[model samples]
Target: MSRSVSRGVVALLLSCALLLTTGACGGGDDKTSASAAEAPTASASFEQQKLAKTRFVANAGLAAGATYQWIVKPYRAGKFKKGADGRTFALVKAGLAGAFTYNRLKAAVNNAKGDPLLSKAVAPLSAGIESLKDLGTKLRKGEAGDADVGAFENIINSVKDAGKSAGAEVVDKVPSASQLGGG
Candidate 1:
């Protein structure tokens, strides 16, 4: 046999082996594979994620008030743009506001080291705020979709609920502290 013909046969055999290995790796439990394939693609569900991010931010900001607005303003102004994706933009804005509010609350809690309850509440509150920031980054990148959005919404709602509970607890603990008091 000619040397060139032998080399061609060897190359063809190697290609077939590679193809078999790849095919075998892909085959798995049919139900699991089908479900995974059926899941919505990221781009298709981007809007939902944006919505969750927005809602969380708004709720957090509302809970925290003025401080939230002040800290998140720059991010909102620079990162968000108006146009077709208005809803998504709004969600991100709200999330940013919430993050800022949470930051202010954390600072206030830190200052009130004498109050352990406030400090404890602030820790989780700070985590919620951080999550909001991460969500915003995802939104900006257009990476998150419906599933992510739903998850984010749940997280924000939880944060809002927690914030409300914490606020009530703080109020009950220190009824006398006026506007002059730390968060």
Candidate 2:
């Protein structure tokens, strides 16, 4: 074999071996990984599922509260105390809060996996994450307006209703900027 060809083969073999040992290449029966840790070993209990549902509701409620505090109320009152810059800040703040809430809600849903009742109630809410994300993107770009705000409120209402059906309803709880991790 040529020297270059032999060197290439040797490098490839070494890389494969390293990957197999580290369980990165899925070369063996070893399935251990960080993601595996997140997977439930067994179906969640009813109480556990309810708790997760409650958590999802609370997180979503925070986003709703943040929207009202930073966007809706001010817009309705026609008092953007800080002017355009302040309006921009409110939009960005609400957007980040929504994003954060979506992530937390996702985690809660994952934790409640295998519970059909809770899952059914949470499905629509989870599916709305994309729309929520898009709203946030629009807000940040200063392209969001009354229609976007109305859509956001409708989403929040749907989530609240779902939470109620699942017996996990929670009032809106405004989260701090630090909590949203967007400050």
Candidate 3:
């Protein structure tokens, strides 16, 4: 199959993995096994895959945005920090570090290159890592710039919009900027 299709398929499969914490799929309590007749086993459609990709990315985006804002809040008032708060920064950083090690995010980025909308939003989502890397560098230098902060906010908004475009599935999981501790 084409690369985009493969990516979409991967995205759908990984949805369960992405939401493992929330017990979204089979891992949760399976209290009911009343129906023996299973649905058709056909693969997810292109649209379905796209929706899954959008949902995963959007949730991830909002989480990243919240992390960025959490880390940068001390510096949001036009004041660069000598050092970011260890606990708050660690909250986001540790999670990001874990995601980088995930096959899901990596596969979606590598395989979804042909999907225009998914690909478009993926760039900003990927750039979030770069922003975090910059944060690491800034930590060494003992200061942060407005540009990094602005870029992260833009990335967050892009993620929010992309998720919203997927309809309720994605939008429902995304937190507002204020909910993310906006200034």
Candidate 4:
């Protein structure tokens, strides 16, 4: 198979694995399941709003972690290591992280919509994720530019600040390279 085709397959497989793992790891409580499935209405209870904010913070940390592991750290080191696929694992990880961040953050934003403070805090993040809708494909194609990275970091910082303002402070939790499939 062509390298590009193989890369696509790897990305697809990894994405599927990520979906499966994440889905299987949920709390499985009624409230958690319900919250994950649908956005709460504007009059959602405090518990639901608090849950949404927590989710928002967690996802933001995940995004930052993935980015640091698969993108920024490698770039700073001046070389991207090849994975078992003989392709730069960083690219695949970057692509996956971008998509994952976008999807999860979007869901978190939607869930937080019922709370004015949480909603406003995530507004900039929502807009930022919108601009990164295609980031996965771009990273996979090696077409992503420095501006993309800059924008991503900026968005992360913006969301963390907003979260703190809303009393939902976020902590950076850079994941291990292996955790992100960089190996």
Q: What's every prediction's RMSD, in angstroms?
A: 23.1, 15.2, 15.2, 6.0
For residue 26, give model 1's deviation from the true position in Å: 51
lDDT scores in order: 0.39, 0.56, 0.41, 0.64
Model 4, residue 43: C-alpha shift (Å): 12
Per-residue lDDT over 1-183 for candidate 4, one digit per residue giving the tens place of the 0 to 100 score = 997788778767876566445432223334563764475554456656677777767766776777666666655564433343334556666776666555555655665564579788777667677887787667755677778777777777787787789888878776554434323
List model 1 lDDT by residue over 57-152, tens digit each.
332444344322322333345333334334343444344333333343433333323224433544565554455445534543445455544444
The TM-score obtained by model 2 is: 0.62
Q: What TM-score, to 2 decimals, does candidate 1 have?
A: 0.32
lDDT digits (tens) for residues 30-138 of candidate 2: 2222334355645434444455555556656776676677666755664433454345445555555445555544454553343466668767666665566566556
Candidates by TM-score, descending order: 4, 2, 3, 1
Error of 2 at 49 (Å): 2.1
lDDT of 3 at 48: 45
Residue pairs with backbone atoms closer than 3 Å in model 1 (clashes): 45-145, 49-149, 54-91, 57-94, 57-95, 68-101
User: Which ranges of candidate 2 are over 4 A from the true structure?
Assistant: 1-47, 79-85, 108-114
lDDT of 3 by residue, 1-183 (tens): 996567645644543244333222221112221121122333434444454465466445545444344444544543344443343334333233223322223333433342455556566567554444444334323344576555545654555565455332223233443223211
The reply for model 4, stretches above 4 Å from the true place, is 1-44, 80-87, 175-183
TM-score, every prediction = 0.32, 0.62, 0.40, 0.69
